[model samples]
Target chain A: MMRRIQSKALLASFSLAAVAGSVIAAAIIYAPEIKPVERPLPTSFDPGEVAKGAQLASIGDCIVCHTADGGRPFAGARALPTPFGTLYSDNITPDEKTGIGNWSFAAFRRAMVNGVARDGSHLYPALPYEHFTHVDDADLRAIYAFLMTRQPVEQVQPKNDLLPGLGFRPLLAGWKLLFLHEGPSTRDPARSAEWNRGKYLVEGLGHCGGCHTPRNILGGEERSSDLSGGIAEGWIAPALDKSNPSADRWDEASLFDYLTTGIAGGHSAAGGPMGPVAEGLSTVNDADVQAIAVYIASRMKPESALQKAASTVATLPRDVASQDPASSKSTIAHPATDTLFAGACGGCHMPGAPMQVTGRPPLSAVSDLRMTNPRNAIQAVLQGVAPPSGRGPAMPGFADILTDQQIADLLGYARAHFTDASPWPDLTAEVSAIRKEDAR
Target chain B: MTVSLIVNGQRRTVSATPDTPLLYVLRDDLELNAAKYGCGLGQCGACTVHLDGKAVFSCLTPIGATQERQVTTLEGLGTQAQPGILQQAFIDEQAAQCGYCIAGMIMRAQSLLDRNPAPSDAEIRRHMQPNLCRCGTHHRIIRAIKRASAVLGSQNGKGDAS
Candidate 1:
């Protein structure tokens, strides 16, 4: 009877120990370090600084995610689609209840720099704190001030419903350990101030690397291959590094022109993700633009030199008949064609037409004709020319009147006359495919 | 609810639901078209404006909350006759396309320059990241802001009309 009593006592002790262990485990799993934040009073603020902060916020595109579609600005609820799961932006307005009304300057800075929320929760990387990490304290203060002064909305963002293992907040702590770095360090004294500035902007707030730089398999930015180019949401963000094959060929003036107006004489137009960047850059100061230009120019590699040399060496034949298959005995075949082009296409296409329709692209300026891809030029020729649908009717299509051979000849003539590039491949098959796709 | 406010230095009154966003009130009722209707939520800087001289996303601001506050729109920043230094810089830099987000861009930039007359490129970029321009002119936009900074830096605080 005494032995049985002793055994029961041992069992009770073991059960109590097990329960204690479980409680400790739960605490470790759930509890995180929460830092205290000092809140800013609305009255004690600098208006000018806040205003400047507002502008910086605009350039950073704070509103894009902070505001939902047709919802109040900074009220959050914008769902950002990512590989892991959908992340909803939190309300940033100065509302005491749902917004960040009570966050201190230091807390705001921590969130922007370390991706740590006030409650010690890990903010998803989609907030781009990795890039924001480089932002200066003054700017953060200003942003905080601006946010504080704004009207607070009572909208609460939805919780991020992530997959099982991904939902754990501790996982982000490990991810941050791998990828997150401290803010921008001191600039290299040897480098030009402009270059340093460009470097900071490109690597930091502009977060050009976020899009332009390719990512690793883990979805982390490939730091070694900076500005090499990447695909984001089906649009290709071109290589911004100096080694770009196209950059070496484009002069600084052309680059400046393109950045300023979203149109350079020839190379390419600002489309896809670049369009908004160009618009934002247009608002930047000339010195900064020059700094960017200086940086870009410095990055040009030898490949650009080769491209330029090749471009200079290849000249088009003046007479189409010299190479025409059907015009061996007929000089009129070439001259007649020249006359037809001069009358029909020369007025707009040769010099470049003004786009009258919305979203209608301008015609090939001499530089555009020189590009490696002749698809645009070929399409323009085959389709004759139509005004861009929404914009203007600067050019009209003549596909109904021109035969396929004539169209091909016109394309050949364009290549010879405007660019030194080789003739385009036979696109008859591709054209049919495009037509069918368009019909669908 | 009826809210009395000063917009671009002009006293005005707006009548709307208390919960109605100041963005809609400014764009729809007051017809101050500089602030845009980008994403209705505040993710885009397209709807940034100034409340009592501080930059705020107007879309998130409710009319009821802005009572007696001074509001400034891009139109208030400057006009064709006498454009703000930042506005002039934006035009000189050719900073707009689609012009859909220019007002917000200007407001944001103006706010930045107001705080730091000479911001570094990184600072400018960080400050401007919240503003989305689908056209990808960020490189130039940074330049334009720097240019405006230089312009503002050279002036001896003469343009603080507000």
Candidate 2:
């Protein structure tokens, strides 16, 4: 969020650069429209290739962004609110009218790898073509085959509402020139085949860095800080590298458990936007997920200062309000929220609780409570965690149950009791703000 | 391990493992049969009780965690002779078929009414989402909650039963 402020400040200079860049871009921004073809029957695709494509699609989490809330999968009206402005996802359901039903393989490839649409319009980077460009031709073809076979949904996604002057499509060619590296990714000679595959998926279709890496004002990922930390859907996707705030290191096993099942023993559960990602990966093949774990774990090295900061609180701090004689006059109920914790959260979060005995991470181990931003914690509380694998403890959201002040009190109590991190200032206001944001 | 709990405003010491769910302590050790164990996983609200005025799953809240909090079960709300407003509403409305989920439904509903004395029917349904009634007794249970809410709202001074 702090980085976002700095990026906003540079917008004036970037706008000047963009105007000059667009001039150069307009000269060479031509893409010959590939002729349309009749919608291919599902039977035309090889079953095995279709199945493989389905797996790849799940790994890519195609449905997460493409599908609008409570809308048909891949019908695509989901409004992706970026710092620049709101961009709507494209309908990729193969609908004859609105979707990619008429898209030929060449047209789809151009769009997938080069960010060009069937009508020769440049797509916003919201599609992550920079990463999609790394995917091999065969894999891209498989994905096309799978998408063409899906239930054809007739939906025309709303046009992107971008910042003024940013809507000029040719300007994106300049962005692509500077950012998009179109080609199959190279293998690291030192790494294993599985690790190489992991890198490909992570860099290509998985596009893990899209949410995990902070973006520049131009919306390109900050390559220097790949997967260090970033914001996703208003929640902090904590750093996955050496700067990871978890007291415990993310090994292959932990990463595998987390990526697949949502919850890992020593680490926090896959919360926020990652919830659906983990759930989607649950149905994927174990080998691919294992490979992903291998690469992700390899990235997570130990940093003592961060680990020390993340370590569980040695002792609970005394409540500062108890010293005040007027403390009993507060609106929040008496006997402290530890009792509220005992009631509302104790079942899954308290030490020695049932979920904890099953090797679930305690409140002390959960990174949300320990993170610098309170948004993740606030989001998790207001909108409870879904049991990732469908068997773990599924928490009911307290948004309807608890007030903002009550939620603030409970989290305040948790931070003081569980972690040594400095308490978040104005948690109640933060909760209210997050609630308002989610409402939008 | 011995755990001290403030149950029904009476300080009681019970010898049990620290991690044992408060549901077992209330039903087994303390012999308070009010909170029933329909689902140990907290999906069913049969084991819900008011822990310091907030309804929580007693089946999940460990006895260890309850040491610092005040625990109130169905028995604490009212005796058989003098039923609480919610309990009376349930009785008047005939909200139960098998009566297993009644206690939990009452506790969960009571927590909502406590927070919002005049919650809308939609709000009641949303608040009671976690609680389940297997006997298909939801219609009556909702009626009972509405009945109690109307009573509480109409009353000039709140009954200090809770």
Q: Report the CA-based lDDT of candidate 2 relative to the real structure.
A: 0.81
Residue A432 in model 1: lDDT: 49
Model 1, runs deviating above 4 Å: A1-43, A159-164, A251-253, A265-267, A301-352, A356-440, B1-162
Worst 10 residues of 1 chain A by lDDT: A385-394
Which stretches of model 2 miss by more than 4 angstroms? Answer: A1-23, A159-168, A302-335, A403-405, A420-429, B1-42, B45-162
Q: Distance from true position, residue B160, model 2, in Å?
A: 42
lDDT of 1: 0.65
Cα displacement (angstroms), candidate 2, residue A368, comes to 2.2
lDDT of 1 by residue, B1-59 (tens): 67798988888987876556778888889878778988654556798887776666676
